[model samples]
Target: MSTSTARFTHLNPGFICENCQREVQPLKVGCRNHCPFCLHSKHVDRFPGDRDNPCQGLMEPIAYEFNGKKGLTLVFKCKECGGMGKNKAAHEDEVQADSYELILKLNKPKS
Candidate 1:
């Protein structure tokens, strides 16, 4: 296999979303870092896309940040170990079942 393919093969191709229990497919644009539906991720990466962490925790989406030309990046907090991580929002996330609405609701301004 090519180096790029080899690198990608090291990452988790896809998984059943823990938060939402949905079968998530590998992202067409890049590695499947988080669930498009619930924006949750596994605590498997010590570095981005490395999948070397041993925590095996469920990462919950806590907040989001604007990434200018790249769009939004969702921040996650691992429920098991309290570690944190961030992932760029997939364009598919906006169209994933109820994800768009939930994301909007979660992003509502706080009083």
Candidate 2:
């Protein structure tokens, strides 16, 4: 689907992380896309919160980027389909924040 035509479904449901097996809570504001503890996500959406993707693969945290306006964003690669995606980090969430250490580890410069 085209970006303009793609549908966005805002569904924020708690789920267990497939990578870390951690019980994750729903986000208080935005959609809870990835696990806050492990920073891993599932390939479950064609668009944001759509939950229409059939890949159902575990997405591995590969890297991160810092934006002045958007703050920290994480990059993920699907283990099954090799598709890549990005998500905004939830480090500032009051209930369950994304791992700052893991975000730093992913953002570190390679020697």
Candidate 3:
């Protein structure tokens, strides 16, 4: 089997934020990729919920965009590999919603 396939594991487990050291709970509806408090994520998945990425880098939230369908999406850049990815903001989640204030802070107009 390929590395990605062999390493793939569908997961939505709660974890402690590496950036802020906050205990994060799993999403009530779907996978919770980043910390709602700091909006930071680890580069651990090649595909969403598939913990197969080897980078294992700290992903920094750099920007945010709103879509009519997806609502708010946060853009991230991997600190280790310099890769980029986007994840839908969970501002409406019942359990641990993404921080709306932080999202707003990131959604500033480019100057």
Candidate 4:
């Protein structure tokens, strides 16, 4: 990730983005910072679906990856936590599933 992206952190309990001004909530769909109307998610995770995180920070969603009949996907990474998690984007989230795919060649460490 670039220096600017390295600063990613998950959005926390805060008012909606002034840019996309709208009411926001937490976990009821994880809308703490993202503007529902704008579909802006924070970056705060390190791996897809791995949430046993120490990074208690905001996660910015870079884009969506579709799984074969599984569902829409959310790609994430946290700046503060360095934790990444991938989730099946929900129906409501699908409304904003507008995303571009990235074939990033991240260094895969020994598992």
- Model 3, range 1-111, lDDT digits (tens) per residue? 243564454466899999999999988776788999999999987777677889999999999877789777888999999988788889899988899999898856353
The list of candidate 4 runs beyond 4 A from truth reads 1-22, 25-54, 91-111
- Scored by lDDT, model 2 comes in at 0.85
Which of the two candidates, 1 or 3, achieves a greater lDDT against the reference? 3
Span of 10 residues, lowest total lDDT, candidate 2: 1-10
Please give the range of 10 consecutive residues that has the lowest summed lDDT in model 3.
1-10
- Global local distance difference test of model 1: 0.73
- Per-residue accuracy of model 1 over 10-33 as CA lDDT, tens digit each: 454667888889988776555667
What is the lDDT, from 0 to 100, of the residue 111 in candidate 3? 39
Q: Which sections of candidate 2 miss by over 4 Å?
A: 1-8, 108-111
How many angstroms is residue 60 displaced in model 3 relative to the true structure, after the best TM-score fit? 0.3
TM-score to true structure, per model: 0.78, 0.86, 0.85, 0.40
Which model is ahead, 3 or 4, in terms of lDDT?
Answer: 3
Q: Candidate 2 lDDT, tens digit per residue, 1-111? A: 333554555567899999889899999977878998989999997775788999999999999877789777888899999998888889999999998998888854343
Off-target runs (Cα >4 Å) in candidate 1 are: 1-12, 93-98, 108-111
TM-score of 1: 0.78
lDDT of residue 10 for candidate 1:
48
**lDDT score for residue 53 of model 3:** 88
lDDT (Cα, 0-100) at 105 in candidate 4: 26
How many clashes in each structure? 0, 0, 0, 24
Local accuracy by lDDT, each model? 0.73, 0.85, 0.85, 0.45
